[model samples]
Target: MPNDSPYKAALQKLFRTRLVARLDDLRQALKRQSRTTILHALRAVGYLTSYSHAGRYYTLERIPQFDPKGLWRYRQIGFSSRGTLRATLIHLVETSPAGQTHTELQDLLHLRVHDTLRLLVRARELQRKPFQDTYVYLSAKPKPASRQWAERQKLAPPPAPKERNLARVIDILVDLLHHPEDDARAVCQRLRAGGHPVTRAQIETIWAHYHLKKTPHVRSRHGRL
Candidate 1:
């Protein structure tokens, strides 16, 4: 945790995400709604905190902002159903190198295709290697951690220069998407000015993958079964 961490700040910044909204709504709804209603809302929002006999409660450690809307990026990628989806994806990919495909991973991890895909895409932690029609999810080359001043300065193991460079570029692209109001053309141009080789095609791909438009499909009464 940094000294300037603004987590304890006002609700405005905190509730900007979907997950926070869900959690807030649930807390409020529970006060007015029935137990059943609260339970259903909790299920939808992935809140399953269990309490034991002695009033002891147990659940995974979570930050205050761990709500469904904050999970929009992952959901957009296809990681279906909330509930530790972020941690699970990181653990799986970290242990299993060469990356796991959509179907193979879904079965292995007991996740639906949509959910799995969404997490993989949002985290930007997986490297997508194209093999014919589909893509393979490889572990993103992690950046080497810098040694502390207390320790002897040693050359830390670094990921391949190319991988590290690509990761930095992609990371910036993801950040840009978060602020869609930022002009894409101007952002790309500024990045290029800073000596980054971010081409229009690469920018387009990032936009397409992250900016998922979820338009509802309406079926006629007769067509609806």
Candidate 2:
């Protein structure tokens, strides 16, 4: 194949045919006086790639082969997948069934989309709702977002049972006082085994009410965390 390197022989004449480089590497190779000045100059020449992780890695446009969706990455840095991060994010959220979270989006795209998502939300191009201690992204339209919220809630686990009665509450406290070292499940086992009506769920509530320290639970292989 014909040499497709952008700099071709020019790169060899300078940095030995290395077409892509970080700001410092390029500056050293070119014997440039200023890194900041050179970076801006490179951007003007259309050689800057998108920053990823914590705003570090950089490469040239040709170093990445952008997929149809306008995305690609090398090592830690990535290239823009399409138009703008904001646009790509909107496209993903629009087509998603369960929407997406900040971490989820980062994991999938290999780039941080938090700032773009914020901009999109403010512009009403997307919607966000609280779900399980975190916000889930959703469609901007009311109907789709509403449906997603409903589905998100429907899929959530049921709340723990409550011990509203005073006598039941006393029984729970008494058990805890007698078995100070017992974990929630252990207390429930003893209570139920002795014919009490209390459940592990109710025991958990008592734990929360008094700000009691919970025993460290060892998760079993069967997913018993």
Candidate 3:
């Protein structure tokens, strides 16, 4: 089609009004029954097919205001400067300082990417490794993957202290003995009121250790539940 073609003008007008158009919409606006002609017109004007919605949507390349991640969304339909969803995921993982996790990707893309991530790993286009309880997606290259892993380690929260004070445990146990109906919070309040300085976490730990339940039943002097 020529630059002065009426079909291209009509397509541009449609895009100006709707911002995004489906292939059918483009065909209708161009007044052409041929998919090839409509697509040719779109290409001539520089168009982007959405990475989302199974590429059902299209917009002019100049229309999107891409974010720092090279992503743009129009009414939940996503467009990526990197092109398809697979390419976008690879780019994001390769560039991330600490890599990206399933949750992180899902949160950012607002789409479930479990299958895509699995496929990328299987194809060796991306790498995945265990991080905390979830897997982190990394660059396929070893050096970058190692750097991302190390950066991820630095970002991890410090481990919780494993050992509880014996005195604090005893204080919590004694308080539970007096008020069997009290839950961990109630026990902590009572112990703190009496200057025991026990935290609810410590009280809960003792309760868990003793297999104790806070119910209406009272404990006998022998300490049997």
Candidate 4:
């Protein structure tokens, strides 16, 4: 961008302090009226757009530091310091302390990556194992895959609270069957409205009992979860 252009000056000033922005953020920051306006401005500034996750955020031509994951995220937005989607995905998988899974990668990336994951596995860059109804992405190399599984076992939520009160629990389970995506809090709210004394903790315990789902915690750019 030309040094004297108002857009360039504004972006440089803003980016000096805050490093990245999503489309909405840029539109608000630039006091623009439309997505097209922001897109045009971004093109002018030669900005780098996120290629993984939501791909909603943009950065100036460069950012100095990145995690071993090769990405930085603030809230729902992410900036991939690495060059492209495939490259960034490879970096994330190859350097991970343990191999990752489609769900785990999707959570970290905040977008769907199963197709890419399958492609990687087919290319011999990754491997996988059947887990529950899904698969855990494994390292093509054995050692890391073994370590990842060991850690995964170690990290598995301890044997879920033993199920008691079969009748009430079954009712709750049937209720959850209708909306398979409800979280514990949501389930609790609906159940309470229906006059059940279901606590979020109780619902969580139930999910544990069934081993329903596992949410993996990802490391930040600095490598802390």
Candidate 5:
């Protein structure tokens, strides 16, 4: 279709008013029976198909305000500058510094991507490895995947102690008797200051085992205990 086509003008006006429309809506606005004709009109006006809803929707290219991830959503329908969800996932995993976990990707994309991730892994388009209790997806490229894995290790929290250290537990209890108001973190800090190698996890373990609660100590104003 030419740039001066009436159907193109109609499509532009329809998109400007609705922001997003279905293929049927496009056909109706274009007054064209053929899907090819409608697509030509849409392309002539510069358009994007929704990445979500099985790609059932369309919008003008200029309508989307894509985020850092190159994604935008209209009334719960998603669109991506990267084109499809599969392509978007590959880009996100490849570009991420520490790679991404399934939960992380789901949180970012607001969609379940288990099957897609599985397929990507099988195809060797992305890689996955155990990280803590979850898997982290990385670039298929060896060097980038290695870098992402290393960075992920650097970012990970220290593993919790598998068993409570009896000496540390006693030290924490002793400190708690002196400073009854101190929470686990405060106890850890004071113990560390006192040359006791106690961690917050150990303190938490002790508290949990004994069901200890830290309550603020109060004193009478008239010098009464």
Candidate 6:
């Protein structure tokens, strides 16, 4: 916006609805209101009112917009970056009090362990427990579901499938499940070794179909499908 634009004037009016300030500090003080008021004013009046710098012309150069307001709300609602991961981490930690390990976060969050940890650390929503390598979500007060929810979560059903697989895949899974404590990846690798081709996702599919315990350390044990 121009330094003397009407939109800016409207925003200033909206912001100054209940404030008093001298001419010098007026701008800074108005900009420092509660986020709700500032956001409301921005949403109601802010737009990319273009201007120039150093005589280099620009259009819609850096006008404030409603989309970023949506983004900010989304972040608060757990929809992007730390919001997304923090949601998953919170669920995992609350559901599995053992606290999800690095590998589990990768699978559950569909993110690299380092990236998940970094975001969690940056947000300060999660903290690593002392004398241990595990992280737990921080809370000023205990939540209603902090521990009870975890107990109920233990009986939650398997994840639903995204796509259909061939019947041959089903047959192999049936054969594998017939064997107890069957190492899922090992079984997959054995199938690969025997030239029975399948994707890792497919193998995981087979395991899920039979309701196997698909833990990260499943590779360490061999048993039923």
Best prediction by lDDT = 5
Question: Per-residue lDDT of 91-188 in model 2, one digit per residue for the tens?
Answer: 77766666778887888688667787888899999989888887899999998888777776766664533546667777778987887778888888
TM-score of each: 0.27, 0.47, 0.71, 0.45, 0.75, 0.24
lDDT for residue 155 in candidate 6, whole number 0-100? 39
lDDT (C-alpha, whole model) for all candidates: 0.44, 0.67, 0.84, 0.72, 0.85, 0.45
List candidate 3 stretches off by more than 4 Å: 1-4, 163-225
Per-residue C-alpha lDDT of model 6 across residues 22-63, encoded as one tens digit per residue? 222433544543544433434454322111111121112122
**Residue 34 of candidate 3: its Cα lDDT?**
84
Task: Write the residue-wise lDDT of candidate 5 on 1-225 in tens digits.
Answer: 545479877977897789899988877887778888888777777888876787888888889999998999889999889878889999999989999999998888788899999999999999999988889999999999999999999977544444556667678878989988877788888889989997787787677667788885557987635
Q: Pick the candidate with the highest TM-score.
A: 5
Against the hidden true structure, what lDDT does model 6 obtain? 0.45
- RMSD each, Å: 22.7, 9.3, 10.0, 16.0, 6.2, 15.7
Once superposed on the true structure, which residue ranges of model 2 sit more than 4 Å away at CA?
Answer: 1-48, 51-71, 109-113, 163-195, 198-225
> Which 10 residues in a row give candidate 6 its minimum summed lDDT?
50-59
Kindly indicate the candidate among 3 and 5 with the higher lDDT: 5
- Clashes by residue pair, model 6: 48-63, 177-225, 180-223, 180-224, 181-222, 181-223, 181-224, 182-222, 182-223, 183-222
User: Candidate 3, residues 60-151: lDDT per residue as tens digits?
Assistant: 98899999999999899999998889999999999999999999988888898999999999999999989889999999999999999999
Q: Residue 67 of candidate 4: its Cα lDDT?
A: 69
User: Which residue pairs come into collision in candidate 3?
Assistant: none
